[model samples]
Target: MNKLFLVPLMLLPSLAFAFPIDVTKKLNGAEIVYNTTTISSNMAAINIQNVGGTAAQCRVVFVNGPENPRVRNTVVQSGSSSYVTANFNRAVIRLRITLTCNPT
Candidate 1:
């Protein structure tokens, strides 16, 4: 009986999911830099850096499949950095992000 159950488990294929991330930026010459990092299966973060001479106001949107989009806004001073994060109720198989910025 134990051998029969073990034999069926050995025939099962590996269950793996590659959670890829895609980012689209609409920054219009604001001298801003950003990157998306996956913190876990249900959480993510965005790091924004400003390397310009003026402050930048940025809007970051995080999208997970079958969930409402998460929006975050922040202002980064010149030569400074900030981070915006999102926590989802469901596991994130893939992440989509839109980053928009303007010089303030």
Candidate 2:
């Protein structure tokens, strides 16, 4: 019926606005950095950096938002690099970060 169709149509915008882009990177012996200039409604971008001489690994987990949380990982090889530019919703989010470094 028309009412049924209308229900789905109304949800389209909200559904479309829920998901964000995933990003990843790798770096070493310095800081890995990411930046964003713009974000839409319920949307945000995440930046990651590594600042050390040894290879490093990191992960980011989002706890709250319009959509479910997600995890992103990066591995920086020795004297190399890794990084990520992630997109997410701005819904009372929490981040769980982990880092590991290899012995030089």
Candidate 3:
């Protein structure tokens, strides 16, 4: 029935916006790129790429409500990419990520 189909269609938009992700980056003259992805309700990952001629050292911090902030560090080689992940103890309704990078 058309009414049944409409019910699912309306939910499609809600599912797409179930969670929101915010990213703040501080790249000091380094050609760095980052992308975020949601793995699950309590997990997320960030993909970092270095496109400059020099290597880069990056620190990533993930914060969720009422949970200890998760921190990760990685060195990305020129023309390469790396991933940083965080798993929280509670459902992540909102996620905040901070990325800081410097040329090495």
Candidate 4:
């Protein structure tokens, strides 16, 4: 094969392997808990915790929406458990969370 062709071939694998993991959080009286796990080749899960005060509210958003980002039938509350799952083709995922206290 030509040298130029060889160079391109070598770079193909690297492209497929380029994945990223990103996360962000904000405080809202209650402590915010976040976590991620790789369940399979193209599947992963995230768990969030609301540990600040009673009646605290939490919301999650995907800055770079995943191929399939859905709530994984879980809830995270103080003294309890809550989580969400995200599935993507690439390795990089970005998300943000906001927590709020009960309105006075």
Tens-digit lDDT track for model 3 on 50-100?
999999999999999889999999999999999999989888999999999
lDDT of 2 by residue, 33-61 (tens): 54432244444445544455555566555
What TM-score does prediction 1 earn?
0.81
The number of the candidate with the highest lDDT is 3
Q: Lowest summed-lDDT stretch of 10 residues in model 2?
A: 92-101
TM-score of 3: 0.85
Please state every model's RMSD to the true fold in angstroms. 5.4, 9.1, 2.6, 6.9
- Alpha carbon lDDT of each predicted model: 0.88, 0.47, 0.92, 0.51
List candidate 1 stretches off by more than 4 Å: 1-18
- Can you give the TM-score per candidate against the true fold? 0.81, 0.39, 0.85, 0.49
What tens digits encode model 4's per-residue C-alpha lDDT throughout 1-104?
A: 59989999998865563335465555445565666655644455566665555534555544335444443333355655466665556554344333223311
Clashing pairs in 1: none
Could you tell me the TM-score of candidate 2? 0.39
Backbone clash total, candidate 1: 0
Alpha-carbon deviation at 51 in model 4, angstroms: 2.7
